[model samples]
Target: MLGKLLKHEFKETWKLPVLVCVLVFAVFLATYWYLGNIPPAASEDEISMAAMMAFLLFTIAVICGNFALLIYLAVRFYKNLYTDEGYLMHTLPVTPRSLILSKLILSSSWMILISFEIFFTIFPVMERFFQLLSTDPQISLYTALGEYISISEFVLLVVVSVIISSISSMLTIYASISLGQLFGKHKVLASVLCYIGFSAITQIITSIFMTPYMVSYVITLDTTTAAAASFQFWEFFRTILWIGVGISAILAVLCYILTEYIMKKCLNLD
Candidate 1:
């Protein structure tokens, strides 16, 4: 039953992400070709200006597209489970828990997909542009990034961070929307307020929780000492990554529980 629900949700929601991905890739390809074809004699200033413009445009589009995807997912959850359509949805034999889980899974997957697309798509283009600008034959972006840490460990940490953070964020939005359904009217407005309130609270809590670790990290970064031992830096950062993963997992679980309870008990489709 949950599988069927997820399939239906994916079918309904896939078009938006597909369209976004196509548009972004098209723009990136066009920009990459244009930048690549710039004449050898083109002045440094001209090349720099063109590259900067392209970078800014692509960056803005990627950022906007990612936000739009998240907003769409949030809106879809609210409409499917809290508005008129929810009447039909609730009549299904599926449990509220199943419905919420399906939505969370799909939403988080889409967020992770977009994050990867942004990273993979923009990174190579930017890397090439910088390489061309510097004309440094030995420059390898990937190698430079992996210099301070084990590549496998860094990649594992990144993947975990992205998945956990995306799930946490999606669940936060879901919880907010569920809470908003309690309002008799102006539910949309209520949802927006709830999102803002949740975000602010989360930021405050994260800041407080991370401050001590951050302070300790800074204190350890004596250039002379750090230069003598780079492994210490990797260990410190790995510890930070684990801390973030733990926090995010806890938050995601809490938000999931909150959303599930609200959907099952306080659901107001009135």
Candidate 2:
């Protein structure tokens, strides 16, 4: 049952992300071709000029493309949340838990795809732009690629952080709507206001708690001696990273549970 639910969820969620990823790749390839085709000029500064133009174009593509993709994803999510289609969803033979799990899984997968599209597909092009700007040819693209790959651990951690953040954001919206609809009237306005208020409060609390750990981490990012003393820099980072991953996983589970509760208890589509 869960497998069937997931199949449908993935089918529903896939098209937009795949399209966005493909568009980003196409833009990148076009930009790469444009850069490669530029004629030799008196000053190699022309290379930098071409690279800068490509960078700007790629940035615009990312911004506009990601915005459209996210908007589509959000519209689809909300539309599926409340409608006759949602009624069919609710009446599925599978339990509400399976339904919520399916959505959560789909959401997380899409977020991962978005991250991969942004980083893997786009960053290499930006790296090429940077490579063109650099002085030494022996300071080759391989060097840049190696440096980027060496920090893959940090990149993966950051990706996980982003996925968790996105899940939390969507869960908060879900919770706000659930809370609002519990009221008989003014549900939309109430939801908006509650979302704002809750977000403010949550941000304040999170800042207070995270500040110390963040300060310590920032200090560690700089502490070459400390990095050498115990674990290597990567190992030191990994220790903190596993802790973060654990917290993120726990929060994701709780968010899914919260969404499921709302779907089963407070959601009123009629």
lDDT of 1: 0.82
Runs off by more than 4 Å, candidate 2: 37-50, 140-152, 155-159, 162-173, 183-202, 213-250
Worst 10 residues of 1 by lDDT: 38-47
Sum up the clashes in candidate 1: 0
Clashing pairs in 2: none
List, residue by residue over 117-203, the lDDT tens digit for candidate 1: 887788777876676566455777777667777788877887888899999999989988888888888988998899899888877
Candidate 2 lDDT over residue span 109-228, tens digit each:
666666667777666675556556655545555454344335676577777777776676556555665566566787767877877886787656556555666676657565456535
What TM-score does candidate 1 reach?
Answer: 0.89
TM-score of 2: 0.72
